[model samples]
Target: MLAALWAAEGPLGAAAVQSALGGRLARTTVTTILTRLHDKGAVSRSRVGRGFAYSPLQDSAGLTARRMRNELDKQHDRGTALARFVSQLTREDEELLRNLLGGAGDGVRGGPQPGVGDGPRP
Candidate 1:
């Protein structure tokens, strides 16, 4: 049900979601899921005539990033949190992270890279 909502290009009605789910889910079930997602800040809804059209607050990539940040914030130790994250990462992800952290072949050496700023706010 959530998959169908996520796959939709824009806000969708319950009927549209049911159709996308190939009638596997009841409209009431989809409504419940949408309500839950809305409470989680993952989805949003707007009035459309007498009913409503539901849509994601963020795209998949943005939602993933938000969830990752939320999970990291729940960890007691920042280092342990990061370590656990790195441990789960694939080789390509590890390499990319290393490069971003000033590993070999990374162009930025002493300070923040261009367009990436660090300092007190104005």
Candidate 2:
């Protein structure tokens, strides 16, 4: 649904979205889904006659990042959850994550150090 809106040249009405989806979903379902997406801030919408036309507010990467952030926020112990997440990452992924957080290269303090040791982390 979001993909359809994102690929559209402009905001699309629910019927258009439904058609873009190859008509696999009913029009009412498309409208309901769009309404839910609008409620969740995943899409922006404006009135089009009696209904609304919607467009994706986030690109694919932005959507994925938002979902990751949302999932992180749901944890009771964020520090532990983050640590566990980091611990499971591959070295290349760890480096990418570190660089993305405003650092470059290796041996950086507070960066994820994958497969460093069997000993406890600093």
Q: Please, what is the whole-model Cα lDDT of each candidate in the order they appear?
A: 0.76, 0.85
Question: How well is each residue in 1-122 modelled by candidate 2, as lDDT tens digits?
Answer: 99999899999999999999999999999999999999999999999999999989988878987998999999999999999999987766765666656654444534345544334334
lDDT of 1 by residue, 1-122 (tens): 56777788888998899899898888898878887888898988999988789988876768878888898898889898898888877665555556677654655543324433333223
Provide C-alpha RMSD values for all models, in order: 9.8, 7.2
Instruction: Report lDDT (Cα) of residue 77, candidate 1.
Output: 99
lDDT comparing candidate 2 with the true structure: 0.85
Residue 80's lDDT in candidate 1: 88
- C-alpha TM-scores of all predictions: 0.73, 0.80
Identify the leading candidate in terms of lDDT: 2
